[model samples]
Target: MKIFKKNLVKMTMKMVGSLALFLGAMVIVPTSLVGSHQPKCPDELLK
Candidate 1:
């Protein structure tokens, strides 16, 4: 019983860590690409 509980805790931690990493990448990649490749608008367009 103790071993099973330990294994379950380890698995849960691993799952949570991977989920957080995946979500971070999903958000960071698009924002980083947009920051690097955004196009400038003409001054007239802003007026």
Candidate 2:
């Protein structure tokens, strides 16, 4: 029983770590692409 619990904990941790990495990449890739473009705001909207 103890061994099974340990394995379960390890598996959960691995899954959580992978999920975090995927989410981080999802956020970072878009920001990096937008940053590279540096879109300018339109002059009409400045009013």
Candidate 3:
């Protein structure tokens, strides 16, 4: 019973960690891509 509980806890931790990682990548990837595609400011604007 103790071994089973330990395995369950390990599995739950792994699942939660993977889920957080997946969500973070999902959000960051699109924003990064969009930022990369955005047009630069005009030269006149820098003056």
- For model 2, the stretches where C-alpha displacement exceeds 4 angstroms are 39-47
- Report the number of clashing residue pairs per model: 0, 0, 0
lDDT of candidate 2 over 1-47, digit per residue (tens) = 99999999999999999999999999999999988996789999998
lDDT of 3 by residue, 1-47 (tens): 99999999999999999999999999999999988886789999999
Scored by lDDT, model 3 comes in at 0.97
Q: Give the best candidate by TM-score.
A: 2
lDDT of 2: 0.97
Instruction: Report the error of model 3 at residue 5, Å.
Output: 0.7
TM-score of predicted structure 3: 0.75
How high is the lDDT of residue 27 in model 2? 100
lDDT of 1 by residue, 1-47 (tens): 99999999999999999999999999999999889986889999999
In model 2, the worst 10-residue window by lDDT is 31-40
| Candidate 1 residue-wise lDDT at 23 | 100
Worst 10 residues of 1 by lDDT: 31-40
Error of 3 at 10 (Å): 0.1
My TM-score estimates for the predictions, one after another, are 0.74, 0.77, 0.75
